[model samples]
Target: MISRRHLLATGAALGSAAGLAACGSGTPGQTADDAKKSEAGTPTVTIQFWMGKLTTGEDAWYKKIVKQFNEAQDAVKVELTQVPGDAWEQKLKAAQAAGKAPDMYIGVGNNVSVQVGNGELADMSDLLPAESWDDLTETAADLVTVDGKKYAYPMLFEPQTVLFYRKDMFTEAGLDPEAPPKSWAEVLEYGPKLKSKGRFGLMMGVTGADFGWQSWGWQRNVAGHLPISDDWATAKADDPAYEKLATFYRDLYSQEIVARQALGPANDSSAFGQNKAAMMVQGSWGISQILDEFDNLADKVGVAPLPTHDGTGTVPVTIGNMKWMIDGKSKNPQAAADFIKWAIAGDDPAVLLDYFKTTGYSKFPARTSVTEAVASAPDADTLNPWRKVIADVVMPAAALEPQYDWTVAEAFGKAMEKCMRGDDIPKTLGAVNTEIQGIIDKLKLAEKAPQ
Candidate 1:
């Protein structure tokens, strides 16, 4: 769910906390040889941790955590490295090839299969205590497991997209502001009414169609995490759900219910923010952006679960943004795993809380306890309302991102673009299906399936 906005520096939303409050501590004995008292009698282990690119706010906040981590524990010192998010894959590949990977890294969920497929990560089942592992949201927890062996520590998660709407627009349109559209049918029904007010009713992302795919995939009741077949050898592009989605977009476009700007180069949420659109489905990150850029309209904005087909239920499409993993070749695997567990869900809620708050409540901590702690904070009500939507609705419905190669997702995006432009849905999907299945075949996906 790292969007273009997250990468670009907006003025710092939440600055780093001055200091961290002690909340809890991990069991002492599990430290193992990850650190030992030097001849100087000081116990210290240098944890080499690499994180993807960060916004100014994220960088400042993370450095504070590293500072606090060093101050709070005498046994572990994290040597933080910031890698450009775009270059992470190439950097990781080169490092692995050169036999000098870092101890741990922050990476995307989609890269899990590739990393595990290439033997880049270490088994973490023993390092992250079972109880600690259990505390993670099940969907996030599922992403790190390969072949039934846990390979990464779940960190931040966000629903790939959520329903963001202007309550004022609904009220202006004589609709219930408290009750947003609950289904695609409702969206179609309300869209024109809102459009009459000189606003586009719906705004779907057309940039890469990732948001569109997520929304459609959920409605079709496709398992959110895995868009392809269970065996990872076929793309289910031809499923009936895709056609319905394409048709929906076409109808919205034809009726002028969807913003024309959304079909252009503008960011998906831009139309909504500019008051030209009543609603758009975007990542939780969009909520903060709106609040920061348009403070006066902050109270008018609201978030709801991504609408389902008939408002009956929703399939989880919450995606793992970034996860922490230990390198298989690390000399300090234990220290690396311990660092992730401690920094994320360990006994301290303050550090994790600081992390999320600093991101302006964009990152959803994967650990249930941390999530609840943030939800109940003193200023919880003061933050964006979407935090509640994320906690109450999105997390509960979160589905695992379908396991497939990144290329498959890109291909699906291209197919969706073609469908939106009036191409035959079935034909486009069929071609996409063949293209993706061909990828699976050429890559020997069956052989790569987690064993």
Candidate 2:
């Protein structure tokens, strides 16, 4: 798999050498064909749908859903294709370049803006029924909206890095397990207490110093547009809050409050699962992972809102939510829309319940009714806690990744790495801010949203 840094570098080099070619013809969606019919004699339409790869049986579950939808319907026949996550972007680009894009494909973070800007994704604001659109959670609906139009419909929401701590560890440290730290200052204060028990207070990045920390700061709802200016033109790498965040992590490393392994490629959850770390910030999906892998530790683990700078509030940051979008060049637009409506926003409790169960309750549906149903179901005890966390903590104050440019995020990540290495924090951030601004100018990101 290509690292995002390498992908951005390749895009820049290619841009300088030849420029990105416009892909796809402005073709209209195909209408139902009379050439093919089901046993009932209704005209049939086959729509091509593509999704990214998943290992945890979600791939099979999606395929099963498609088969069920096909069997239950006569007007539409869906063709499903699973694309590897690493290659999905390249494949979509290639197909779009050749004017053969699939009817529907999954849209990930920041790509929604990129594709919408390039006119590669279909306008979905008025495509689905208004009720369907209204059913989406505010954050899910807002994430796909670019220039006041919805381009994609969210299927699931996986908020990143809600604070997961060990109740046993908290009790051992003479702290109240019922009351987790409410602010970053409290988290830092707990470090020494946890360290006395031979455990780190928190483990954030474990493998390449991922972007979780950035989201930590963004969720604080710091006074200004984070990592970017309000206009979305200038890089805000030099923002005081960003510098403070980087410095805080640097201090954590220097003080040995956080293990060095977490800064590397080791999964932090493993450390948490093994009781090596007293606390760590992880996605909602990690709850199922810890439960499934280490059932013995189930009662010991606890989930809460990730700490803010001053306990102001918490906001949900997108972790692994998948958004479905219609391809701009799709031939079966209405058929594809119909299928999405049925699968996602449809008022079918049985189907939605099965979808929630099929993924082991790792995915949270974006539809309010589905979420409520799952929470009320007596057999869904494993997921009921998470539903409360999502409702009370995550969704109410949700915010998006900077969305201006992926490179901005990459640049900030590099700056954080330099800080972790004990480099001059101010100088490193200053240089990165200037460099990112240069990239923004070169890509004309200020004039248009970037990929």
Candidate 3:
């Protein structure tokens, strides 16, 4: 493992060492003369970046990472910037219109889908290694892949959502703490029991819905009912699978098993802390906060994978990731790709495993080696089991996280939101599916039209 001592030592530790320690050898992004002068002068190459808020003290960690890269390599210096969560999508649209979008970005699974189709993003395939990238997890590669061509360098591979339960409360309710429901029917059965105890059985997001995000067909991708076919065309949003999943989500709330909360207003974990609900369908990352911030209830909490519709327990959940694309218009494509490779190496399973263990989150490495290293991690006792699940349960499902440009998902989210709010299902689904078809056709991604 790379040590902090090695990272902090300066001078010889400064330039080439930084490259070797981090990105290794960079493909030259500039002529020798251009790079030579950069080393001697006040070096700068404003490569704009858009990424989510990293909790690790950004100033303490990220600023240092960027500075080291700039000093270590004459490649275009990264001009780090934040894309505020709420306004990220809006700002991206505005920037693209002005022809001044960031050179690199970290966005959600759906954003890539939209940008890729609009030709708003650059291809990252040429710069990355084609073979021997076995360190990357099977699913991590899928997050940024489309039609067999890779676009994004995977950043983090995580279970998009997980189920959380209370320990003390279960004991008081005379329920076995170790035994959580294994199927959706079990959850419904337990809901009434939880309610009898004056505890809210389940908590839903602001929409008070479940079916919107995770689904039977689209989310699981088992049916291959993509808005675009393998080539890129719209398929049916009203397919049997879609309707079955929608009913699954809606019935929970209507049956009083899931309750609505302030999820839309702010972060969802905060709602759980208020003690208004007993359980939440939350991201695996939340485990860290619950254990850290809510010390009073730390031991009282335990985690279990969500109950599935059937005993199979297969989840549609996936690892969320974004690719780092080089600016096609960049005069220094080589340099840009070099920086990107280092930046994305964060996905290398080894790197990810360290991050997940050290951070106390449920994230698994995007690479296989990192996942294997769990036995050696200081936090192995906690990390190992989750690592097994990520490698086997979660990683296998990750291949389904919409690798094709996400334009269809944009339509999917909008259509679902409307229907969740009681909009006409037939009209909304029809219109959204039509819009998705147009997007697929525009991108030349779908091969055959729906009959």
Candidate that scores best on TM-score: 2
- TM-score for all predictions? 0.75, 0.77, 0.74
Best by lDDT: 1
lDDT of 3 by residue, 330-389 (tens): 444444555655543533445335445554645555556666665467666563334454
Which model is ahead, 2 or 3, in terms of TM-score? 2
List runs of model 1 lying over 4 Å from the truth: 1-48, 54-57, 71-77, 81-102, 129-131, 172-175, 189-200, 208-216, 222-227, 233-235, 254-276, 291-294, 357-364, 375-378, 381-384, 447-451
- Cα lDDT tens digits, model 1, 39-133, are 23354457788887655667766776677656554555688888876688799789889998888888766567677777788888886667778
lDDT winner between 2 and 3, please give it. 2
For candidate 3, the 10 contiguous residues with the lowest summed lDDT are 11-20
Q: Which 10 consecutive positions of candidate 2 have the poorest summed lDDT?
A: 11-20
Give, for candidate 1, the lowest lDDT window spanning 10 residues. Answer: 11-20
CA-RMSD of model 3:
6.0
Give the candidates in order of TM-score, highest first.
Answer: 2, 1, 3
TM-score of predicted structure 3: 0.74
